[model samples]
Target: MTTIAVVGGGISGLVAAYRLRTRLGPDARIVVLEESGRFGGKLRTVPIADGPVDVGAEAFIARRPEVPALLAELGLTDQVENPSSARPLIWAGGRLHPLPAGTLMGIPATSGSLAGLVDVDTVARIDAEPSVPLHWDRGADVSVAALVGSRFGEQVVRRSVDPLLGGVYSGLADTASVRATVPALAAALDAGATSLTEAVGRALPPPSDAPVFGTLRGGYGVLLDALAAASGAEFHAHTAGASLRRSGCRWEVDPVGEVDGVIVAVPADRAATLLAEAVPAAATQAGRIPLASSVVVALALPKEAALPDNSGILVATGEDLAAKAFTLSARKWPHLGAREVTLARASFGRFGDAAIVDADDDQLITLARADLATVSGVTDQPVAAVVQRWHGGLPQYRAGHLEIVAELEAAIAGVDGLEVAGAMLHGVGVPACVQSATTAATRLLATVAG
Candidate 1:
């Protein structure tokens, strides 16, 4: 029988083990070691009202086939639910402005459409972007702030793009790689499109009435629980694998027994420590990947709080608040609304901003409440509240991130029976992690078959 060790119990690690079982059959013995006591690293659900609410990742981009397909495979397709409200408002210039239609990651297809969100001068600068000659090719990659700010203006990046991108990456636009974050815009620029407007229009997928994102009717925890139950891998919670070494043909997990193969699925920092002896180059590179800390506060309000009708509000930089974004949970998801209770969530801590995340749970909730009240004018005390702090939660993809990832992968390839998979290595969302894990599992299976 072939035995494999997976060093992490997050969704990515679990998915890899599950895939390995399906491919290698019952003869394979899979062991999953999680450093933490609980599973679902970022897919947590907190009890609120009559049901549970996702306090971590609330939804996944449905356009990505991996998550939906996985859900279908797990017999969870019937519970897939779309957001009741898709529109999001951006807080800027002392008021809330609806994120304009026809924008890709807040890069407007038509700059004129952004008039409501930014100042007149910014709009004028954007209008002149078409006259600026195209200088980049498809192969070129640059920071989102550099490309969009140079073409449109700094105000556009600070006011519009930064908040939207920040909500996703927990990182600033000036440092994030455009190619890695918004590939469609990068591809358009790389194609040598003369105008940003035309490039976006050409690059964006055709309009669709289908929901852009989907989540389980109950919570993501439902799907995660199902996956964990189906995996059949021996789970060792709170067992952190310390190092890796090779034992002739098999791989050895330090302080633990040996396995035929090993998957290092923890965060980059932890993975680096484990792989340092076996794959020094990859370990060094992984250690250098930046990570960000974040906090989320979930508030259950009285039914009459009168929250904003939009899905959420993304806070623009320079806003006099600690919060980076706010999601009116009950308004956004109809299922939450069905409970006859108002729900809201506030997010804090950006890539370079970590101090706020260190606050105690009470302080964090107070901050969230203050911001929520300021933006939505709902000052009533919450019926219940939950605070979740994630240290080194999000991985930052700096400019040249793709190149860095390629080098890391190449370095790991030299080590037989060793594979690395996680959000830190690829995209950040649930679907992206699933895709990365699936690829890693396939590669490992190929080695066995060979």
Candidate 2:
């Protein structure tokens, strides 16, 4: 039997073990090590007085194939639910406005697409006559905010991108890397888009039957529980890896004990310590990728309450409130609700914005209540509230992030029977983690077989 140790019980590690079990037969003994007491690192489903809530990743994108397909493999397809039909509102221009059609991720390719959301002056600036030219050469990495403001105009960032992406990444659009965060749009611009009005006319995929978002019936935890069952790997909770080193031919995983064939998948900061002793170069490079903290506050309101249908709202920079972003938890997936339970969630924490992360549970709820009351127009107080703090949650993919990842990948290649995988390694979302895991697992298994 081939023996392998999978570190970090997050989506990637568990998926790696599960895929390995399916591919190499059940004879192979797969051992998974998790630093925390819980198996699913980020995929957590918290319970409310009436219904369940998702404090971590609220939903997965349907356009991204990996997670949805993976869920089906775990027999979770029947459980998948799409976002509600009602439109989502962005808190901008001092009030909520219905997001216009044909604008994806807040980037409006057409001037007319700004209707209902943006003012006329902003719309006229998007016209091709006075379009400004960006000097970014091919393959040059820049900020997503810069690309949108320079090519699409500043209102595009404030009106669309700010509310849409700000809700997810929790950072200024310009600060987030164009290549790392939204590469497809960046590619279109790099292909010689003088302006968004010009670029959008080129024609892309007409929206598909699949909605923008999806969630498991039982919250993200359904997929986590399935991964636990499918991956026949030995499990350890609350065991933090001290340091890692390479022996003569085999690698030594010293998490207060010696083990072989270690896969370090913790956050970049935590991974830095293990990789430093095992592969010094990787440690040095990993440390350069900084991680920030975030907080999510789950609120369940009365079903009779008047609010937007099921879609949640995202906040812009320089907002009156401290929340990073939020969602209508029950609206995305009906499985989240009970007889009269109406669950909602909002996040706090962004670069240069740390209001809710440092606050206690009581203070956190107070901030959320005020924000929700103003934005959602709900007068009723929350029936239930839960605050979750994730230390080192946000991965900063600063400029030249890919170059650093390349350097980190190269350093680990020198070590025998060792590999790394996580959000920081590749893309930061669920799909990226799954894709990175598939790549690393194939390489590690092949190395062992050779």
Candidate 3:
């Protein structure tokens, strides 16, 4: 039996190993090495007074079909449910506004529902903004905020884009690169249709029955557990990988002990130290890929809280609090849950901004409380609040990001029988990470076969 060592037992590594097992039949021996004691990495769904609440990614975007399809393939389809039955809030221009419809890339595609969303001058500029042509070099990289702001206006970036995209990338617009983050936006712009209006119009998928976003009935942890089970991958929790070096055609991965044919899927910084000898240049690029630390405060409130119905609230930066965004977990997926059990998630810190990551637990709860009260109108103290600190959660794919990623891949090729996976390359979402897992595993298998 051929042996493959899968490093990092996060969802990405587990999924990759699972696919490899499925593809290689029973003959392939797979082992997963996780630097942390836990296997889920960023995935955590803890029990609160009301029920379980996710501390990591809460929902999978609707347009991404692979995640839902994969859930079904893994027998986890029944676990999936839409995130919300109510409108979400976006904080901008000193107030929270209902996320306007017919908007894409922070630009409103139509004006009917956006009346009170923007100021008069900003509204007129947005109205007259000729479907600004999105002209970007295919091979080069650009900032998502810069691209969006340039095409629509700065207001769009400050008002619309920052609130939603900020939560996903968990980074500033200037630092968040387009190709590494939202490639579709870059692609649409390159295809030449002035303005996100035309770009989104042309790029929008044909209407389908796909739900907007879905979370697991039990929480995303179910999917993580399912992946581990399917992979039959053994993980050493609480173990920290010190380094990795390539010897001959095989790689030596040190995560407590040396393992053969290793795949390093940890953060880019760790990847740098691990792959330094085997792929020095790639290690350099990996080290250069900046990562941001963040803290997630999951506050569970009783259903009888003093607040109107809202799916969730996203707090913009420079607000009364430091949090970038928060989600009303219970409101988003009530069918799978109960009204008395509202799960509010407030995430702090983005790429290069680690102020909140080191904040004490009490501070986290306090900030979360104030933000919830200001944004959601729920001033009642949460019955239960758990703080999860991810030292390096989100990677900032700055402008010119794709070029470096390509260089890193090339450097990885110097060492054989190795592959990279996870958010460092693709994104911080569940779907994109899964997509990277599948794609990278396929390439790894083919490399080994060749």
- Candidate 2 yields a Cα-based lDDT of 0.75
lDDT per model vs. reference: 0.86, 0.75, 0.74
Looking at model 1, the pairs that clash are: 137-190, 138-190
Candidate 2 weakest lDDT stretch, 10 residues = 196-205
In candidate 2, position 108 carries an lDDT of 69
lDDT of 1 by residue, 1-450 (tens): 888888998889989988999888877888999999888887798797667888888899998899989998999999998898557898887788888778788888777668788888888888877887867756667898988888888878888889988888888898689888888877776676778876887788898888998888889888878878888888899899977898998887865688888888888889889888989999888988889889999998889888988899999998898999998888888878878678889999998889988899999989999998788788989899999888888888888888888988999888789899999877999999999889888888778656
Judge candidate 1 against the unseen true structure and give its global Cα lDDT, from 0 to 1. Answer: 0.86
Best by TM-score: 1
Pairs of residues clashing in candidate 2: 145-173
Off by over 4 Å in 3: 25-27, 110-114, 131-139, 195-197, 207-209, 255-260, 336-340
Candidate order by lDDT, decreasing, is 1, 2, 3
* Each candidate: RMSD: 1.3, 2.2, 2.5
In candidate 1, which residue ranges exceed 4 Å CA deviation? Answer: 137-139
Root-mean-square deviation of Cα positions for candidate 1 versus the true structure, in angstroms: 1.3
Ranking by TM-score: 1, 2, 3
Of candidates 3 and 1, the better by lDDT: 1
- When 1 and 2 are scored with lDDT, the better candidate is 1
TM-score, cand. 2:
0.93
Using lDDT as the measure, which candidate wins?
1
Question: Which 10-residue window in model 3 sums to the lowest lDDT?
Answer: 251-260
